[model samples]
Target: MHPGGIKTELGRHTDPVAEAQMIRTINQRNAAAGLPPFRYKTVPQGAATSVWAAVVADGDVVGRRYCEDCHVAQIAGDPEVRGGVQPYALDPDRADALWELSEAMVGERFDPLN
Candidate 1:
């Protein structure tokens, strides 16, 4: 997780060096757990917008499930919401803002059926 509980994909003022260090830590933990290491990449500007647009087009239920799977238990929170099981990113207003920004950036309308 990036500093201040921000998602990496959001490209929110992340320090590249710090992010690389965090990725190393994550890989170390994964190795200890016998899990495959995750590949890390510096997210490019607007990439999150494109991805968010696609997710929004996929429908809220699907998007929610995706968020839960990817961010759940990863974001900071109390015991009941540990590991992002209930990510703040999934909040409706935030989701809406993401979708809007995505559309504005990409110049595409989200088609739920697409």
Candidate 2:
């Protein structure tokens, strides 16, 4: 699902040829933006499970995991907005509260991986 709450449907089978083409397209755009091309890797289920268990043990929460909920709340506030969702124009008080909460949760630096 996209951050905008749009659901994307994918084919059931893995298509390596199509995936490679998509990666090439992504690399072209990344190169145009002076960014490094992404490296793709396939890992076994056991490896992936161990990695996820380690991450959870480290107390790291993926912020984007909650993006759907946030977007739902944002869109629920206005259904007829031109951009499909209202801009998150928080007032000064709300902004300050958010800042304080963030600081308390993750300190000054917003590093979820650390």
TM-score of 2: 0.30
Candidate 2 — worst ten consecutive residues by lDDT sum? 64-73
- The parts of candidate 2 lying over 4 Å away from their true place are 1-12, 42-114
Which window of 10 residues has the lowest lDDT sum in candidate 1? 64-73
Residue range 26-111, candidate 2, lDDT tens digits: 67766766666755323343244344544443334433222222222244243232222334533556656777798898767563
Q: Residue 26's C-alpha lDDT in candidate 1? A: 70
Q: For model 1, how does the per-residue alpha-carbon lDDT over 1-114 read when each residue is reduced to its tens digit?
A: 211233465666789899888778777776766666655333442254345445544554334343422231244454332234345665878777888899889999885432
lDDT of each: 0.52, 0.45
State which candidate has the highest TM-score: 1
Error of 2 at 16 (Å): 3.9
- Output the lDDT of residue 102, model 2: 89
Candidate 1 colliding pairs: 72-83, 72-84, 73-83, 73-84, 73-85, 74-83
